[model samples]
Target: MGPNVHIWRHSRCRGAGWALTSPRARSQAVPGTPRHPLVLTETAAVSLLNCLFLPRVAEAASLPSALPLSASWKELVAMWLPAGKASGRLMKNSSTSPLAEKQGQTSMEASSQSVQATSGYPSTSTSTSTECKPQVLPVIIPILLSILFVACLVLNSTSLWIFWFHIKRWNSSLILQFNLVLMDTLLIPIVPLMVTYFSLGNSWLFGQFLCQLKIFILSTHLYGSIYFLTLISIHRYLAVAHYSTRTLWKKKSFLKKLSLFVWFVLCIQGLPLFFVLKTSVLNGTVKCLSIHQSEFSSVYLYYSIFLVTISFLLPFGISLICYALLGAIIMKMSSTSLRGRVMKTKSLQLIMVSLAIFIICFVPLHVSRTVGVIVKYYNMSCKLLLQVEIAYYASWVFTLVNCCLNPLIYNFSSEKFNESFSKSLRKFRFFK
Candidate 1:
């Protein structure tokens, strides 16, 4: 052969070998290649070029389909040329040089895969981390809450009976105690449902209406219990600080009206909960006490913060001031007789028990709930979310146990309440 013809034949053989060995070419290979090293016929070269260029032609055709017919052909040609050149160079080199073609295709595939993998992997990991599971409250919470439910039911029931029928005289203190008992009684029935909910891993079996009702009752009880306790402290203050003002609080009718007013206000305050509170599926598990999807979640959060502040913090502050003033008065009083000293001691015990109830039962709940509201509104990190969830539920158990503690408080602090309770028990032959 002449020099130019020999060079053309040599180039055609190299190009054919490269095309046959390429990744894309191997995938599209016909089954009739000879068992000799790095050789190709003209027919094989044309087939490989057609296979490689077909996909690029389809991609180029799709671009103009999306554009208007009057769109500039220059832009269309500009976009098509780069993709066409890239495929063309691959085909040309594979056809010309077999050894370089295999190495180049392998590197290209590896780099493309690495780029795709690097981009793809983090997205999956990020999604997994962001979907952190809701915190699971400790199993002991439901157990403890169940125990409190039973004890609260019995104690609050007895307290209600004694105040309603056993006690002969109903003073402002007894009236406030009766209201407190009534709140506890109303709240106790829902505790078993709550126990079941927590025991079943926060899955709410109860329907939506009951879920809303439970939330409303619990909220009402929370505020009512605190408000009444504060009222009792204020009553004690009035009795001690200005003994002459006894007749005003002494009237049963006035105390009854005040208690009624408190109930009215609490019910009004809690009406919003009916709209906000509902049962819904979260993370594929049914949950109760979650706010329904609304444009007003932020509105509800602010309202809740306000309600807690007014109903809890304000009363808490008032109770502290009243108790402090009462403590000052008791210190100044003359206690020459043993009976006077005993009465003074009992009064001090009452004050201490009230303070203990407020501090232990309500403070943690309010604090945790405040943190929860902030976390929910601001979309905090998963770690902060889990922490707030744990605190909120743990403190909630403490709050639920308050009813059981109140009866003990009454028995320990109030001489009249103890006598009435003992009489009622003896009448029932609970203790012979």
Candidate 2:
């Protein structure tokens, strides 16, 4: 508008889309600067150049009068943003930025003030846990998991002792339930330390081989828990449902053969993890882990989940149905006394506890962990440690709950467990 404010758009070179901020840089102008990219008069383009991308080395480094933001954005525009074919970045920025330019000066000042506000005021609220203490977590979470894990193991061990020595001298039928307890006693010790490693943000201070071994053992034990519970359900169903039928021990060697088979498969099942799971460093923190590393890993976590349902959950559900069916059969066959009713009711109650534990301690963990694995394998950027921490921390509690709950499962399922446990107490009482 003013005579001295010359809005003259000049050419840097005829074909070049150079938008120089400095008047001296464009002092040697070509015939006519292509003005469409800037969408601005020379004066407005100069104003934007003055306002934003200049100050930092504008004096020292002479750039093209106009350059695109990146080689990629330029390529993208050329390939797609049709306007770039006719004009260039300066024109596009100038045309789009008039209202923005007016507000930008105000907003940029406000932004700088906000940053300074944080520096000056300092947060007065002590209740806010804004401070990050990743280092402290490794040292602390282990101690807590260790205490809880030990408590769980102690319960499982007591359950095992009752099953092993105190329970009535039945055949291997009762021992099926006890195996759950035995596995928990054997399996749970590795967890507190692993939880500590996980709490430390997945960094494995443990060596490479230990990392693989830990993952293999953890996976094996977790799956073993699932298998044993399923076995107990089937064992109990067979006993009560087919009371008139042949005993499990008397026919087909089902007791010994089946026990050997389940463990044999579980041992083989763990072998894949031995090769795949490893210590990984991400964002400078080490994590002992696996997220479908191979085609195998993807196949394993998901397909196995489906397989777990088909082989374990669905079968267990069938066992529950059979238990209910058998209870009805018992009610019809003999309504003689309260003792008969009490025994059948107790058997049903035991199976209910078994089902409850799986739903309570396992289902949530599987759902959350599967979601995490999907996001991770797809390489989405949102793997924030805080999110990872929350997800994994919740998962461990459930998963470890699963690891430790088997003893109660055994006690609930077997009647021999009650008589034998009482006898053991009597023997110990006499010794004292």
Per lDDT, the best of the predicted structures is 1
Clashes of 2: 17
User: Among all windows of ten consecutive residues in candidate 2, which has the lowest summed lDDT?
Assistant: 1-10
What's the CA error at residue 409 for candidate 2, in Å? 3.1
- In angstroms, give how far residue 152 of model 1 lies from its true place: 0.8
Model 2 residue 264 CA deviation (Å) reads 1.5
Per-candidate TM-score against the hidden true structure: 0.70, 0.61
What are the per-residue Cα lDDT tens digits for candidate 2 across 38-69? Answer: 23234434443433333322322333333343
Model 2 off-target regions past 4 Å? 1-144, 163-168, 198-201, 247-252, 290-316, 323-338, 380-389, 425-432
- Per-residue alpha-carbon lDDT of candidate 1 for residues 193-292, written as tens digits (9 for 90 to 100): 8889888888888788998899899899999999888988888788767777656776778999999999999889889987776777788887786422
Off by over 4 Å in 1: 1-129, 290-295, 412-414, 424-432
Give candidate 1's TM-score: 0.70
Alpha carbon lDDT of residue 422, candidate 2?
65
Model 1 scores worst on lDDT over the 10 consecutive residues at: 1-10
Alpha-carbon deviation at 242 in model 1, angstroms: 1.8
